[model samples]
Target: MDERISCILSSLKKAKLTPKFRESEIIQLENIRSATMEDISSVHSTSYISSREQVMAEEAVLGHLEHDELIKDW
Candidate 1:
C-alpha cells in the first residue's frame, strides 16, 4: 500500500494537473455494496452462489461470493 501510494504521488507530482476542487470542497461519497447472486442471476443465466459467508483476510477482504470457486465451477 505504501509503495502504491508513493508511486501515484511521485508520478502525478510533476504532471502539472490542476485540482478540480479544493480539499475543503470535497464531498463525502456513499459506498454501494456488491450485488448478491440472486440479483445477478436475474441479468444472466448463471451466477456464483457462494457456499459460505464472507470473511476478512490479511491480503484482501473476501467478497460474499467466492470468485475463484465460481470460476472453478464454471
Candidate 2:
C-alpha cells in the first residue's frame, strides 16, 4: 500500500469512536466549493469587489505589498 494511505488508515483506526457522524457533516462538505459570483455580490457591494480586484491586480504586478499597510487597512 502507498505510505500515505497506510498512514491515513492507521490514523483512522486510532481515532476515538463517538456517535455515528451526522447528516449535517455531509451537507457542510458538499458546500465547500466557492459561492457563485451573484452570491458573492449579494454579500459584498459590487463596487467593493471591483476595487478589491484592482488592488490585487496591482499587488501582483508590483510583486510585493507593504504588510503593515495592508494589516492597518484590515
Candidate 3:
C-alpha cells in the first residue's frame, strides 16, 4: 500500500476511537444524488459558477507550472 494511503487509513482508524464517532455525532451520507449542471445552476448563479470556474482554471495552470518547476529542479 502507498505510504499516504496507509497514513490516511491509520488516521481514520484513530478518528473512529474518538468520542464524536463513539457518540455517533457525525452524519454519513449513504445515498448520493448525481446532480446535473442544471441542478447546480439552480442553486448557484451563472456568474458565480463562471467566476469559480475561472479561479479553478487559474489554480490548475499554477499547479502545473509549479510541478514543472519542481521536475526541472530534480
TM-score for each predicted model, relative to the true structure: 0.24, 0.40, 0.44
Model 1 per-residue lDDT tens digits across residues 1-74: 23453466455545633133234654656897788767776866532222122122422452334444422321
Q: Write the per-residue lDDT of candidate 2 for residues 4-35, one digit (tens) a residue.
A: 53465456445622113333343334547767
Candidate 1: Cα lDDT at 71:
26
Span of ten consecutive residues with least summed lDDT in model 2: 16-25
Q: Sort by lDDT, best first.
A: 3, 2, 1
lDDT for each candidate structure: 0.42, 0.55, 0.60
Error of 2 at 13 (Å): 36
User: Which candidate leads in lDDT?
Assistant: 3
Q: Per-residue lDDT tens digits of candidate 3, residues 1-74?
A: 22453476567667774334554664557889988889989999999889767765876866644433422322
Q: For residue 38, what is the lDDT in candidate 2?
A: 88
Candidate 1: segments with Cα more than 4 A from true spot: 1-29, 47-74
